[model samples]
Target: MAPHPPQSRPSTGPDPSAIDTSRRPFVLIWEVTQACDLACDHCRADAHPARHPDELTTSEGKHLLDQAREFGPGQLVVLSGGDPLTRPDLVELIEYGTSRGLRMTLTPSGTSSLTPETVHRLSDAGVTRLAVSLDGATPDTHDTFRGESGSFEQTVRAARAARDAGLPVQINTTVCAQTVDELPALRDLVDELGAVLWSVFFLVPIGRGRVLEPITPDRAETVMQWLSEVSDDAPFGVKTTEAPFYRRVAIQHRRDANETPTDDDIGRRLGITAGDGFAFVSHTGELYPSGFLPESAGTVRDGGLVERYRESELFQSLRDRDALRGKCGACEFRHVCGGSRSRAYAHTGDPLASDPLCAYVPDGYSGPLPEGRVSGD
Candidate 1:
């Protein structure tokens, strides 16, 4: 087999411009199962306790891996789920994808199943990286957010075990009204865990997450600005999940310090919007531009993923930065920070609408602004 692509970040980010996103996604997320042990408040999947009877079979999973490889070698495939560990054939699937020249990553629920043996098994199976969520620094807050009594401990243990097993660990944190207060402490925890990356996921109200609170645009602005400061010295790389304005904030921060971004910087921090550089495949085979953006392009059961992603109207609309509406459409950083399509759809029915969470409003644009305008303040 071809050696796996060398990766500097857990996300395996390559130069975004070199890759033709119209034909292939930078990252493909496959929800292997919806069956999970934890009931996370912000769970996009609204995961089930038992596996769906119609969940893709092991053979079907191999076929999907084959389809993923069609994107080209070194395609990043993240095996996400309610908890990937629930799937007994997860390792087999990872091995198969790795053999097909896909850079395989896994996001498993932190539970009793995340033992050292399980981590070692995943490492031995050619899994490129392991991402575990740690929303809060303390057990009380994190466990409460997860709706489990011991999930915090399990998450910490699993991250440590993954590190000991020679697996690069990435910590996924939720940023919202409920958990945002703990971010500073969680940053310390991320450093303590020796994580390679800290993926701060700004919450999008979906499913169980609908009941949870999203931070206001001003609050998000403050947080992203602070995170920009944190990234300056944090050992691990930092990326926001649903908030692309962090890129805008970072760029502005650097420029304010009279630092001009190099050519490498231009490609490394691309804002991968829904249906742009990212794609998601549900457990039932439906292909979405993003898990948070439920607008399905088609199902694998009906058509090939390549056709849906490349030629579908929805994907096409999302990829066109010019098609974006309101402030996002006029923003100078539109291409580099296209805004979060998922959050845009959640706030406005139009997937091409501007992300309300971003406080930046481009100058000289007279269109109606987002609800909370930190406009020129």
Candidate 2:
């Protein structure tokens, strides 16, 4: 028998990007553990079976929470890792962070640890949101990417459990050459799971991810075009991670359609790039511009996070679009879409290099490649 086609619907909530967060970093990604049971092909943490002995202690975690309050009160602190659920003290950490007036989110690798009881417990512990990774639509595709059999089934079960427990779920999908073709099917799956948000993370090669081939610049642009169309009719808010250029693409699309673009839309696009309104603290407390951009600014143990982020050379470089090398520095959309530093760094060793995955030739770009422009992998 033929199955019924999935129905298209509009998102009930406001655009996820429109949610007002202060210009300062209003969110922090804390990798609380580096241990995982699965060896996914594109794992940024290069996770292993055993937990790191030097991973942040419970006392240190509480202290980091204290520092986070000073950095941005009521900030959204995301508890992530190879799999945050691998840590026995995850709930305790969540409770502590919540008690400190921080909104908390959890990202657990879909594995045996994400049981039904675990979902309810996380909801009870004041986790406002739960994000699970779903790279592919089908079991064979997804499980193969995750490097574990039945991972797709387990992730589905976990997502359903989280939704049924009244916890909002966001499905994070990694978009790469290998997975791009499956986005339509993944979208249908997202709708079926009733996910509130579908976050498409463009590949940033680092750690184990270095081996995976990222989609070409032209392909990324095409995917963004498709995403711009999808977001308009999808029942859930759609967002792109590490692909800030989507904002520029959206603005151009709106302009081409003769629709008026709002200031909020522009502000939202310009406000949230890698080091500007985002920061990451590794499992060992080293701070970086973002989880994907692994150049360390300083350790949380060295000084206050706010000070380090504001004062670090890398952060400063990332914030100043004029400092970018190659066509990115000259792009008209440079401010709104400075391109992905992590991607730039992944392809070239310099984090300040232009994002190789951006195909858009800036207005006034000359014939030959600009001086100091680094070639991509």
Q: What is the TM-score of each candidate against the true structure?
A: 0.93, 0.89
lDDT of each: 0.86, 0.81
* lDDT of candidate model 1 versus the reference: 0.86
lDDT of 2 by residue, 1-377 (tens): 44322222111323436544233474579999989998998999999989999899999999988888776455778899989998999888888887777778899998988898888888877788899999999999999999999899999999999999878899999988788899999999999999999999999988888788888777888899898888878888888888888887878866752344443242243546778778899999999988998889888964578788777777887888788888788777777677888888887888778877777776567633423343441
In TM-score terms, candidate 1 sits at 0.93
Superposed by TM-score, candidate 1 places the C-alpha of residue 42 at a distance from the truth, in angstroms, of 0.8
Among all windows of ten consecutive residues in candidate 1, which has the lowest summed lDDT?
257-266
RMSD of each: 3.7, 7.0
Expressed as tens digits, the lDDT of each residue in 27-141 for candidate 1 is 8999999999889999999997899999999998898888888787688999999898889898778888877778899999978888887887788788889999999899999
lDDT of 2 at 131: 98
